[model samples]
Target chain A: MATKLARRRSKAAAFGVFNPNHVVGGRVAGLIVAFWTAIALLLWIASPWKTLPTPPEVIHALHDLWWNDGLGPELFTTLKLIFHATLITTVLALGLAYLTVVPAMRPLVQAASKLRFLGITGLVFPLTLLTGGGYALKVALLTFGMASFFVTSMAETVLEIPRSEFDHMRVLGASELLIVWEVVVRGTLDRALEVLRQNVAIGWSMITMVEGISRAEGGIGALILNENKHFRLEDVYALLLVILLVGLGIDALVGLLRAVLCPHARLGKVRR
Target chain B: MIPGASVGEVVLDVKEVGLTLEEHLILDGVTFQVKDRIREGITTGQVVALLGPSGVGKTRLLRIIAGLDAPDSGTVRGLQGEELPAGTVGVVFQDYPLLRHRTVESNLLLAGSIGGLSAARSEARTQELLKTFGMEDRAGFYPGQLSGGQKQRVAIAQQLVVPRRFLLLDEPFSGLDPAALEDVSKLICEVANLDEFNTVMIVTHDIRAAMAVSDTLYMLGRASKNGKHVPGAKIVGEYDLVDRGLAWQKGIMERPDFVALEHELRGLFRTL
Candidate 1:
């Protein structure tokens, strides 16, 4: 008991911000959340909508999109791409991270991966040069171009794990497999998930861009491009609204997973 | 001729060990042997405080012994019977670094799992450690939800996920206050005594804490990585506090000896 008290006192002394007497009211948390919502509402209100459709019109448009026939199928197509593309990215990332962190393979793999990163720079502009067009090519390019991004981000997260954590496990007599599964995989999951979160916006955008270039049957990018090419400005904005809603939905899903998989993560909980 | 050369038994031995960080000589010519088990028969225990001036390589020596670093040269030998490599031993550091993402139960599971603890036995050990640490209530909470003392307790408990013949700790009680330090020290004693009768070597400059719990003690001197004594870096003195008078033991913290020792250690750094 004395020890517990002393620990509390010492920690209290170290961080001066915490007021022992401060009671966090449930209402204050709600109010702070409302303040953010009010700001978003104002942004939506002020987004040059007078020259186009207002926020209410956009909401009504969304209602029609949801309630109208065939739109649900269009939404599902984009969701499917997000799901498959994320899975591919994660798998490639995990494999690359394994190669990067596994000690026996670390040096050779790191050296090779570094070279791979250099090689990967070719993806940005070179793809526009080679295999210039076609739906198949666009999908292939998106997958290939983004594949290295997945590997780099995941491997980097795995590499950044503290060495001390590994040493502690090594001394405990943990085997390489157990260390990988329990220590490395478990420890790095949240970080890799964060990498996933960071790339979500970019990943979707890239996939949509490729989809449009390839003349893919579904996805917001294709839909927006087709409408804009036809000079259907109202449809273009309407498609833009659809894309924003879907992006928000995807963001919300990842956020929920983040809360479940790594609740203690102090950062990335709030998104812009 | 070495007076202690004929010491009958040695379970863990460090011979002519040294380490350096940047240009700073962290540990110099540190030598000690822990003969925790003689002929597989556990012997009476001794708690030795590794004390020195603050800049000495006290903690570095402990880390080298823990296999956290490769000593510039020399050797560390742990139990010959165990499967550990020629120079491997279990280690615990100053910061507990318990996994904040996992439950107390899962944390122990990770420790046991990564330590290559038998899957069944390790899981069982997790349950047992939970009971032993009186952390059954905390078994479900993440590290973020735990208090500092509890986190350290869990960290210490995590160390016991698997037991070996020797344990190396690097100033495990530094940031903790007197009472918490005592509790942790007592807990360390109990855990070490219960496990394979693991010989424990703790590195600390805390004179009072050194007296609090230890079977024997060594004072480190700061020397180059090659273990040569520098003009300013020397242990200067050593002591065996176990047999000291009760008055000295009880009053050591408030006494001149500890204060003078503390000042002497600080003097080594300031003069250097």
Candidate 2:
């Protein structure tokens, strides 16, 4: 009797009508339906003149802009800026976090934590003096903007590491550099990636502001300014969609990277 | 080096080590030495216990010995030098801080790689230690999945996966039931018996557990005098468990000599 019931369930599953495991729970499915429905209704209401960009029109504009209007290079430039800024921020944050572990350098870390309230946008003109308003200025702005938060998060991550792990590494006669690599880096890589993921979004959000202020050529921010100047609302929507899609893509890539780098996290073994 | 060194010979001399943190002394003028021992032509390592009450600097002293912490005024010399050679000391921390990012097998493999062992040798040794610790079935399990006793066993086995002349176990008997404690004690004795670990120091508050597997015992304590707080830990007592050979045999805890030693250690703690 049990064998017959199991066979029936398998047959039902094969037909796609009675899957024992649903793709989403009932509540989640309902929420997703409600969310998309609300979006559709909002789009309809906002398109009284039927110019709020249908999906096909947006896709067509995206294709035309990406292929002919230099959108690809501008997009790449913005991404490159974010990428380099995140890299520099990570290295600086890690160095700062390492220093905080030293008793003598703890005061420095406390000072850095307090500087988080200083706005990077406010530093635009001051930093332009140090770096003559090009890639360096923009990169510097983003890195400085994100650095304090990254350092604080990374330092907390470092502290959350059980001291015993560091002791264990030292007992193995590991050199200072080796301990940094084997214990600190490996122990905190998962959370560090998380910090980067969160900080990169903030960096991206500020990218357009910096680029617009600098009037940088060949960037999404410049492109947005150009579109806004011409009153091409459809093209503006298309560019906004491009930015949204790119941000979501980066997020997905980071999630995949995290999964590969820290499989233990997927197993729910990470303490936080 | 010794004039004519035997196998498993390691000499440790800790001289007048002092450390102060934030105006509170943790270890002041602490000194001890472990001489090489030869028993019937077999060079046996000395398993010593750093016993003290809670809040004393037993773990701090162990950290100093492991080269994890710097002493304010003294030096720890092993193998007749200022420093212990790489991969000569392996520590099992009080919390058994196994790598959360790796499984049991991967943790051992990581230690092996850090010690610069060849991959084949590391793989072979990891398997051997896993089997020895009765964790053959748990090689793929993460540390978070293990019970307290299993985590302790894996922690010890992870260290043994690499070659080391000294093994330091901090509070190995903590959070164990009576049966688990006995089992872990036997495991420690077996590891200390191996020729690789020429010196073993266990920092523990459980006097009976410490006495069970250690061949020598040292006590650290803090005392107040003249209405002033005494800074740092001081060596209070030393006992040679080697002189009581029969106490090391099975059911030694039930024996009168073991009971008497326990009472004496308790009395010593009371005085502190």
Candidate 3:
């Protein structure tokens, strides 16, 4: 009987990471940071860096950049860019979602959304070919590309909304505009935010790429590109530090918004 | 379409209305009408329910009535001599789709807010609903944080926020078990008789739920087959259930009338 009891418990315990203990471990706040830190350190060590300045030197360089090279204006520019991107993406995505799910336009929206995805993907390549060598043009192209995704993912999220929620909102006698504002917008906010957050990192890289190609002036992206092109190892490390700190700050902001706008609720068990 | 039509003037008129979805005939040749008047104390209310098995279009009927869906073959007429503009038909749908992002307070504030009522006015109405529903304590909580029952409570609160007589409820009691069902049933009864404008229409297969709160009940069938550009689905029967008083349906659901009603409803069609 005791052996049977142990055997019954064995399979239950055998499942990895789904054990209750693992659930508790997963919920710990900084577990992800710890895991990523270990991986990042491993990558840093495995990759060549002797000739490159160390992390501390990079930090000092970031401070110097802030103090001497003027971090404030560039930071403001990046912030402004993101804010505009977010706003434009939100309004356009909302309209696209509403149009996409309407039963009459459901098929057309479905077809159009598919076309838009292809169109947006096509847009990305042309930006590479046409916007040949201007950082400002590249920024515009990248922002446009980012907005296209906002429309796609957001519209998809909007389209995939549980039919049940849509029906309930209608039963509540919510106007079409009201449905867009309240139901569709709220339902898609978390997902749109996730896409926004994901693309933010991508945006950073894109900026650096533009700077590398276009020789733009003064932002951290430009700083990174400038340091690397000129072979200034110290400045490269300093710029990397700037990138790291800024990335973390943006990630933290995303987390704050998630908590404020998408925190766990009882129904979160069912829908995101 | 006069601005303020009176009793028997047809708040909702469905004439030979038929609906089709993905080649499935959900409702066919369905026709019905209701007045705009809430029942009062010491009097039977103008509460109506649509009862039928799943896929029978009990909800489709409600949707047509609520103007959430336009009938493929017919038109819907609203209380003020035209179909009340969308969002004008206060409803409590089966799933209790509360805005998960909003607080219980916000969930309850929907109608009043959309009606352009003042913040203070809507707040007061929300307060009244919260107090009545015993969810005043959860006012600040998001739907994601609330239990299934709590979400339904908020949904109910949303439907009741406006002082309109018209309503469309779809399987409002199916999600709740016996005890909370009792509480919700009682609350719905109280709301139905709140003396605003009037008629309450519900769609539910649970006869006991129908008999408990409805003044009259209609039964739609599973898969109507009218066979037109739109196939046919139809309302099989309409019933008057107002004779049963508040005390009649109290604790015991196994009573003769209850059992008979259940048997009668089950006899209607397939389990859908």
Candidate 4:
């Protein structure tokens, strides 16, 4: 039994380490992750830069921000802003994407998709002038910044749908309007959610830049910028960690919602 | 014709349908007609097979028949001799495209509703189809959760939820094991028997399986002029399996005559 077990272990190690397409077992994968994480920690600890905050300092800074500073409220403010912007962007992007089925709408959809290449900095002046430069401006800027990306992804999804799908609906005697609703609206809803998830991350990254324009709003972005201005490196690090955790939480939540609402999305994917 | 089956009015008439793509002629004057088969005061559905080599424009012709695409010349007329409208004929693509986000039951219900059934009626039909397709337990499952055969079944059931007279299947026998092949063949027959006017046109290269299930066989190939090959695909051969006493028979594939015909068709298919 001992010899058999040893042989199996050797064989697994041989395949797992060098085979091009061989997938490692769960335990081995977990070990690899732990090994890499430990190496990164060691490298960080042994860094030559004296200005870099130690792990303990970063942790203490996080605690201080949670208790002394208004991190919780600032996070809530950012979350609320993201929620509103995401809702508006979703409706606009989906509408524009679905309209591509119309011959006239194709050019407009193409124009909207191309808008992503335009820098948001160039549009901020016009956006501020239009919105009177306040909280509304920040929301407008975020929405403008994210809308093109969302539309691009969704339009591609809409286009990638095979011609057979529409034919399938038509054969069922579906009216033109019904085909749009069934194939475009409902058929791609799950993919829309996925696109939303990706765009939300992009929006989150841009929140700080947008909030910097409206410091009175007091979002996490503003807080991070203010800390950076003071040269409080540890606090900045803590704030960044907070942002990472919050973003991950939001991503996971949206993914979970997709699984619940569109459970079919995860089917046929390789599960660990 | 089969002993008790009588051919009736032409249900589908294709006249000189032709298509060209990017300076290349794909289909040249493809013409055929499908007539209703009546037996014992019931309209038993007809199964027609379209055989062709790869890239012989078989799928393009099928798309034209399904009204998903228009031919550059000629017309396809339905039962009333009117131009076939998009969605008038059902199509099952080779990949069995289903709305990935929807459950099997929802997919069927959507098709039924689009076909003009009321919500309650659609629900009732969905249930009946799920039961009939032996997918009652899997009605809650999504397309991605199904095996290839199961997905094919759901795809077929999706079309049947609506009262479609003509159905087009593209490569239904492609990529199936022996057992799965037999199962799909049986399912195709069952689909045909469900309604008298329900006609199935299968676009495939699998001669044996096509011959096993289809009552009529049409071969698409480039015609030869003066011993030289022509550029476009056209219907080169037509066989009435019913008149030949080979269609709708149990264990027919094992018979000597069937084997001989299969061998002969195999030789002909290689030339195309």
Best by DockQ: 4
Q: Which of 1 and 2 is ahead in TM-score?
A: 1
Q: lDDT by residue for model 4 over A229-254, one digit each (tens)?
A: 99999999889889999999999999
lDDT of 2 at B233: 83
lDDT of 4 by residue, B112-214 (tens): 7677789999999999999988999998888888899999999999988878888899999999999999999999988988888889989999999999999
Residue pairs whose backbone atoms clash in candidate 4: A170-B87, A171-B87, B43-B196
DockQ of every predicted complex: 0.31, 0.42, 0.41, 0.66
Model 2 error, position A235 (Å) = 5.1
Better of 1 and 2 by lDDT: 2
The residue-by-residue lDDT of candidate 1 on A173-228, one tens digit each, is: 66667667766788777777767776666667666566765564666667667766
Candidate 2 Cα misplacement greater than 4 A, ranges: A1-165, A214-218, A226-239, A266-272, B1-46, B70-87, B98-123, B136-148, B222-233, B239-246, B256-264
Residue runs of model 1 more than 4 Å from their true location after superposition: A1-50, A55-69, A102-135, A264-272, B1-8, B19-28, B35-44, B78-88, B110-124, B195-197, B223-237, B243-272
- Going through the candidates in order, what fraction of the true interface contacts does each contain? 0.46, 0.69, 0.65, 0.81
In terms of lDDT, the poorest run of 10 residues in model 2 chain A is A16-25
Q: Which candidate would rank higher by DockQ, 2 or 4?
A: 4
> Distance from true position, residue B186, model 3, in Å?
1.6
How well does each candidate superpose onto the true structure, as a TM-score?
Answer: 0.76, 0.73, 0.74, 0.90
Task: Tell me how many clashing residue pairs each candidate has.
Answer: 14, 0, 24, 3
Q: Relative to the unseen true structure, what is the C-alpha lDDT of residue A191 in candidate 1, on a scale of 0 to 100?
A: 75
The share of true interface contacts that also appear in candidate 2 amounts to 0.69
Candidate ranking under DockQ, highest first, comes to: 4, 2, 3, 1
Candidate 4, which segments miss by more than 4 Å at Cα?
A6-39, B1-5, B38-43, B80-82
Residue B199 lDDT in model 1? 71
Interface root-mean-square deviation for each candidate? 3.8, 2.4, 2.5, 1.7
Q: How close is candidate 2 to the true structure, as a TM-score?
A: 0.73
lDDT for each residue of candidate 3 in B1-272, tens digit (9 for 90 to 100) = 11222234555666788888998877778887765432333443467777776656676767777767787787777656676555777777666777777778877787677766798999998899899888989999887777878877788778778676676766778767889887877777777666644666767767777777665667776442454222445767766543333222455465676567667766654532
